[model samples]
Target chain A: MDLFISLFINGLATGMLIFLLAAGLTLIFGLMDVLNFAHGGLFVWGAYSGIFVYTWSGSFIVGILGAIVTGFVLGWITEKLIITPVYGNHVQQILITLGFMLVLSECIKVVFGPNSIPVDVPSYLAGSWEIGEVIVIKYRIFIIVIGLVIFGIFQYVLKKTKIGLIVRAGVMDKEMVQVLGINIKRVFLFVFMTGSAMAAFGGMLMAPYSGVIYAEMGMEYAILGFIVVVIGGMGSFSGSLMAAILVGLAGSFMAYYVPYLSLAVNMILMAIVLIFRPQGLFTNAKEG
Target chain B: MRHEKYFSLKNLTFLIIIIALIFFPYVADSRTLTILMTQIFIFSILAMSYDILLGYTGIVSFGHAMFFGIGAYTTAILLSTYNNTMMIFLISIIVGMIFAGIVSFLVGLLTLRLKSHFFAMLTLAISGLFLVVAEKWRTVTKGNDGFTFRAPDVFRDRVIFYFFVLVCLVVVFLVLRRFVNSPLGKVLIAVRENEQRTRSLGFRTLHYKVTASVVAGVVASLSGSLYAISLRFVNTSVMSMDITLDALLMTIIGGVGTLIGPIVGSLVIETAQHYLSGLANDYPIFERWIIFFGMLYILAVIFFPKGIVGTVYVKYLTWKSKKAKPQLPTQSVPLVKDKERFE
Candidate 1:
């Protein structure tokens, strides 16, 4: 029972981290129909920049803020320079974004040097709580709380805000939203920036959670994010959360029980899902 | 009906090129150049196989390395465990191609129905699964540590190996060209242009796509076998994403839809990589050659989206048409008379 509880918590924490990355990916794909392969680059940048700030300023809050800012600036540049030209062409978008992804990864190696950096959990969130036989780690709980709070905040904003209405409308029918005289282009830029910020935010959080940050981690986690997005359904917010949790739990349990099949498990799950639900589990029926 | 001419300028150019390549080893005594040329031939075959999907069929797969790795591992295991004879090598290549074809056929049926984005991600995931299996199956694969093996007696000589690979490249290229020019190839092109229209016309686009996937997979496996034989080694890195990306880069840089483009692309890329990495000894900046590669990739997509061969072909056509414009006035008089007669 103790092992199960700890495993469950571990899965939930990892799920939240994946959700943070997938959320942005889904939103960007949903609203703009732009598959940003370079999203991973934004992620690693966030980890590096945020970690740099954290060490320099000796404040985690400042690091998080710095990461978000880096995401925004990078997102804006990527959208304007790389994505704007290949807006409607999927092939061009894939090729260009992949190129940009390579550039982003190489740039990280250039700036941070070609070594993985070890990250420490801050003093305030270091210990664990013991309840009978169950010992709960504080950092894991902190990540879960942060994920839930962010999810709640985003849900509130998406449900109630004017920008949320426009975004939802854009996702449904961009032409219809444009017919209503909204500048859909601006909305695209705004959504791209927000999604990138979320990815960077996830990266910043993941750095300490994993205890080591590397340039290549972006690609590794980005694949996880892509899997979550596919399982969850493109552009479906709640679906992403649910699918991410499912994947997280599956990965955690598989690692413990069938160690050899740990990595293969995710691919198997994705293949099963693809076979059954081509449109994805959470895809809107109308869209399908 | 009048038969088409067989000895056109294009045919002559190709024949000359083939003849020149057949004698290349004799003239070029430099062992490094011979090896480099051999590597280019192998990669060119791989890139051509990719072209059948990305260029002819409009499918973008990120898991092409899986087939390549399958070919390499099959040959490696067979030659190392059993007799290192020509017969075993031949059987291994055949087995690898068949295995790749079956896997690609199944993968196509499962994921080709999804949108391009889904297909790309699923292929990547599937390839990653293959990588994991290769890494963990240490008993057979020897895992990431990898193992080296002796080549067949015939391929032990570098000159013989070079000629052998050159013949394979030429044969594969000619076969693929004929495949693309056939009626079935035309249907594949139609499917790429507009799948719904092709389906509405009762072509069953899925069958054609699966066929292309299998063909591409088979050819890619052959290249993989050749690559392993050339190196006389096998490793899990053969299944890595980098191999797939290299193939993708080669296809894109040469030309997507052009059969000859991939050959040129492999030549440009292989030479560039060799020289750039070699230059790392002298210039410290060349240590990060991938950054330069990425920049070149981005520029290619932005400026030369059609690729080197594709853009040049387009330019040649436009020039030919301009040159023929003077003869158009003579033909216009008949059209004017036809209009007058109709009125």
Candidate 2:
């Protein structure tokens, strides 16, 4: 029972982080119709920047803010320079963003050197809480809370506000939304920035969780993020969250039980979804 | 009526490329030749197979390496304990084709239903999942330690594995070339050009996509098998996203829709990467190779998006049109019509 609880918690935390990355990824894909492979690069940058600042300042909150700002700057530059030019061309966007992914990865090595950096949890979040022989890592709970909070904020924004309405409507019909008098370019920029920030935040949080940050971690987790997005639905935000949790739990449990199949489990899930629900779990987008 | 062939540019250029590739191992240092030629052949096959989906059928699969890896592993496992190189090769090809066809068919059913970009994203996710499986599923795959096998006799005699690859490539090129020009090939092209219209014509476009994808998968696996033969090695890296990117880059650089583009593109990129990395031992400038690759892709698309072969064909056609008799405008018919559509 304790083992199951630990795996469940661990999985939920990982899922929440993936949800954060996938949220940004799906938003960009839906809003601009641009497939951003560099989304992972942005997430990695967030992890590095947030952790760097956290270590320097010896403060966890400051690290989170730093990561967000780093994501914003990185995203803004990427949108203006790389994404804007290749807005309508899927091939161009993929190539350029993949290039950007490499460039970002290289840049990480340049900034922090080509080695892994050790990440530490805050003092208050380091210890485990034991209840009747069931021990739960405090930091895992903290990450889960952060993920849920972010989801709530985005959900509220998506459902209640004007920006949310534009985002939701834009995902439904980006071309029509453009014809309706809003500057879709601005929306693209906004989505790009938001997505990057969210990805970066995920990175920063994940850095401590993994306890070390490396350049390739972005690509690795980005893969996880992408899987979550696909499993959830491309343009569906809440779907990312739910799918992420499912994936997280599946991975956690699979790691313990059927160790060999754990790696393939996500793919098998994707294949099954592609077979049964290619539209994804929470997606309502029209099929092409 | 049979079109009169005064050596069409595609045929002529393809011949030139084939000849150059054939001479590669002979002229260059054995080590350099082996590495570059082998990489080129592997990617050439990869790019050609990719053309079926990306160029001919118009399904952008970001995770095509999954099939390539499947073939490599299949061949590796088959050949590891078995001695009949020919039988193993044949079995591996069938295994690769069947596996790719089945997986892609199932995946294509739903993801292919997605619009273009989303479809690509699904492939990426699915491939990523494959990587994790490859890395962690150590029992069957030996996990990160990977798997190794003795290099097969390769060509059985003096031809060497490189020449065998060359021969296989030539045969594949011929087969695919014929397929593209055939009725089925035309339908695949039609699907790429306008699926809805083809559907309106009562053709099942999805079936063609799956069929083309299966053939492409088989071809890609052939390359993977050849790669295993070449190196006498197999590892999880065969399924890595890096290989997928390399293949995509080659296909794009060679030209998206052109048949011969991938072959030419692979030769150019792999040779350059080889020389660039050979420059230093420490840095290998391999990272710089990535930089160049990244830069080359953007520059290639921005400046000559049609790819080297595509641009060459266009230029050749343009020059030929100018050289042709000013008296007959009919010679410029195809070129003029294509340009008109683009404009």
lDDT of 2 by residue, B1-343 (tens): 2484859975787689778877876677566567667678778988999988887786778888988888888888887768746767778768876887787777676677666766776788787777777787777787767777765565544347677778888898889988888899889878876778999999998888878877887788788777766666777888988888888889878887776789888988888877777774676446456666776776775666677877777777677778985343332111001211101
What lDDT is obtained when candidate 1 is compared to the true structure?
0.89
Instruction: Look at candidate 2 and tell me the lDDT of residue B124.
Output: 82
Error of 2 at A114 (Å): 3.4
* lDDT (Cα, 0-100) at B155 in candidate 1: 89
Across all candidates, the chain A TM-score values are 0.98, 0.97
- Highest TM-score scorer: 1
Which candidate wins on DockQ?
A: 1
Q: How well does candidate 2 score on lDDT at residue A257?
A: 98
* Interface RMSD, one decimal, each candidate: 12.2, 5.7
Checking candidate 1 for backbone clashes, the offending pairs are none
Q: Which segments of candidate 2 are over 4 A away from where they belong? A: A173-180, A283-288, B1-26, B84-111, B129-140, B154-159, B282-286, B322-343
